[model samples]
Target: MEKPQPVVVKVVTPEDREEAYRIRIEVFVTEQGYPEEGEIDHYDAVATHLILVFPTSDTPRRAYGTVRMVTLPDGTGKLGRLCVAAKLRGMGAGALLVRALEKEAKEMGLSAIVLSAQVHAKGFYEKLGYGFPDGGVEYMDDGAPHVKMAKTL
Candidate 1:
């Protein structure tokens, strides 16, 4: 069995924002069937984006995962648009993205982080300390069942 490649997460620079967008397109738009136009939205203008990449010298730095955090009025960061390349699933890249986002949230002085997680991924979020809202309920989000989750920073 091959060991997973080491990955690093960095805040997406203005010039490299396309790298983040491309990863999101591959995961959400092309693979998950989200509308391409909707994949890039107004929130992107206000959110802080991060990208996961390999540091191998053999190839140019290419992003494999991406996530964003937007500070909300309630003093919480809204975590959204998380995606990892299909080929890299189960490589701990997703957890690293979430951990990096948590650090970003702390730097922004956010009280907590909130997200609407796909129902199937509830356990993933739970493992990262995200909990459902009191009396939480699942609802349709863009044709998929999702549940509200939050984690204190």
Candidate 2:
């Protein structure tokens, strides 16, 4: 058994946005059965997108995970559209993506960060210092069960 190499996560530039969307499409639309049209939305235009990439000698690097952060009107940061390539899910890529988003949120002077996490991933978010508001409640989003979680930055 061997440990997987760490990946570099960074804010996506104009040229890298496509790769971020690609990973989201693969994980959300194709794999999770989300509608193609709903996979992308207006938030993408204003949000700061982050992508996890494995360094390679290849000309164009591929993204293994992605997440986006948008500053709300109230000054809180919202994290959404988190996804990791199927093959890289258990390799800490998702956690790396989240930590990157948290760092970005703090840099922007946000008071807190929030996300609507899929039900199954609640524990994962909890481990990352996110918690449910008012004990715990579930809601439906994109036809999947999700819960709201927040962490102060």
Candidate 3:
């Protein structure tokens, strides 16, 4: 199969809300078996910024992956709500989203970006130049172990 061209990344708007939510529902609720209610919470509206990916023109521009960015009072940025469609894993969608978020952060005058990466995915984030803040792991959401990683933009 032909590889997908580099995805065009953009800031999610009101029009993209449903697409983003649908992607999340597919990845988190259906594939990962997360409870629908728990997968989406209040933080979505108040503290999240979504990155929408249109990976190809031939196919519908579905929300293949999304990462939420939150700006702290000190002007730092936090990335959360990361999800990628199961069928599209190993295609660099998550990394592209992170890079896009970093660009957005730089534009926002933030010095760095942070994320609580699931332990299994730490290597993926590390390869993209993020370093773990704490030496050990943290079981933050449910029993999933995660490491807080960050990169200075």
Error of 1 at 143 (Å): 0.8
Off by over 4 Å in 1: 1-5, 57-60
Taking all chains together, each candidate's TM-score versus the true structure is 0.90, 0.92, 0.84
Please write out the lDDT profile of model 3 over residues 1-153, one tens digit for every residue. 985554645544665666677887887788777788877777677655564565556344567778778788878898887888776688887887888888888988999988888888889989999997777566766567778899989
TM-score of 1: 0.90
List, residue by residue over 1-153, the lDDT tens digit for candidate 1: 675465656654664588889889998988999899898999988888888887666434588888998889999999999988988888688999999899988987889999999999889899999998754699999999999999988
| Order of the predicted models by TM-score, top scorer first | 2, 1, 3
Candidate 1 accuracy as lDDT: 0.85
Candidate with better TM-score, 1 vs 2 = 2
Summing lDDT over every window of 10 consecutive residues in candidate 2, give the lowest-scoring window: 3-12
Clashing pairs in 1: none
True-structure lDDT of candidate 2 = 0.85
Cα error, residue 110 of model 1, in Å, equals 0.8
Superior by lDDT: candidate 2 or candidate 3: 2
